[model samples]
Target: MVPDPDLQLQMVIKALSETVSTAVDPGNKVAQEQLHLSIATLGMMRSRLPMTRRFYRALAQDALTLAKDLEEKTGQSGALTQAMNDVGQALTDPGIENEAIEQSRARLHEAITDHLAQIDKSLGTVARDIVMQGSLGSIERQRAWFVESGFEPNADRIPAISELIQTPDHP
Candidate 1:
């Protein structure tokens, strides 16, 4: 059978922790930064296992290397907050089965779809306002700004803003 990705992630975090712990100079800034970046990028990934704590919280609680970028992104920690709420609610439900979890996943999927649609619509309105207010570069720049604003524009970000640039509505 294929190994679970969440287990793989756990192994990774363990490896990172061991490596950092055994480093000849634990205080090295570069090593710390690499650790931080890895943890930050891993922050958005949810666990397939129900038992895991959100990554940053675990790191903080365990006194592991803290991710600076992840910290910056989670100013109010809404993603982490939502994660805690979702998982907490799921785990606490004594009657929850895989089937129930699947249903929850389906609902979450629909919620995500609706949320993205709303964002797209809001962006459309913003684009119109930008044009009415006078600008030729609104959409192109918005896409660039998305990339700049800590979004992985190339990875998993669908209908990439870069792709959207060629569409008429954006211009």
Candidate 2:
């Protein structure tokens, strides 16, 4: 059965609230777990949403706030920091580059590249082949798969990536 998107969004907000309330101790295992889980949940929600600029902005704002809170409490750089950076990079407007945003993106990109390399090493050839094969299909085919997998067909708006991913060659 399909899940209610509104309900899922509420759950994500509730999880974020709970994480904020219990996140006093940066080293606390429970708090760390909650924070990570909340982040993952938010990412999933963002992926499922119709990709309007407003939606992206809202998600970025929430993630930025959460990342700031985590940084303040932990006094260290980690996944939250990287997530914040990625959102910032992904949301940046063209021809209006900011130094801080650029720096954050660079750091996050480097970290993710390292992580992906580690995964590639660990998962070996079979996983790599599987991932490559999966990614080789057209976006329309992927959309069909999403529909088959029970995603709502009538997304409120076209995903922002549809516009952003287009290049002169493709267009």
Candidate 3:
């Protein structure tokens, strides 16, 4: 059940775009919260999915650019600026092993779990299942890409990523 890499990439791009759009109104509390959660999830995906890294990076860059524009227009740093900075910092140096890397992985796992909970709550069980299946497929493809490219998978993160893939009923 491997999802198409291109499709998965497109989905991520869409998600990022939506996140930016939702964050456009600085006064919107719900949108701000969504932006925060979405960026964290995007960062997690960027770290875990090698094939989608470029797209994720592009999204992060776009958010940063948008933040800069908004700040210049408004003459003050806003939530968007802070959110973009957080996401950019997350994607900037995803090293294989380091205290920072470990912290990033932990944040990613927490974000993923929160996202799955939201999906299950808002979209119903069927949609949640579809998303989970797609995510697992995407992760498998990422692992395969790392192997094919002669890079060892990050040993510390692999088990955490695998844990996200496992169904509660199965293990």
Best by TM-score: 1
Residue-level lDDT of model 2, residues 50-114, one tens digit each, is: 54333334333433444444344334346645666675665565443344444454455454334
TM-score of each: 0.27, 0.25, 0.27
Candidate 1 per-residue lDDT, tens place, 68-109, comes to: 222232232434335334533554465666555444434433
- Number of the top lDDT candidate: 2
Task: Report lDDT per candidate.
Answer: 0.41, 0.48, 0.47
Give lDDT: candidate 1, residue 117: 43
Q: What's the residue-level lDDT of 144 in candidate 1?
A: 42
- Residue pairs clashing in model 2 are none
Error of 1 at 141 (Å): 19
Q: Which stretch of 10 consecutive residues in model 1 shows the poorest summed lDDT?
A: 59-68
Query: Who is ahead in lDDT, 1 or 2?
Result: 2
Residue 108's lDDT within candidate 3 is 43
Sort by lDDT, best first: what order?
2, 3, 1
- Which structure is stronger by TM-score: 1 or 3? 1
- For the record, the alpha-carbon RMSD of candidate 3 to the native fold, in angstroms, is 23.8
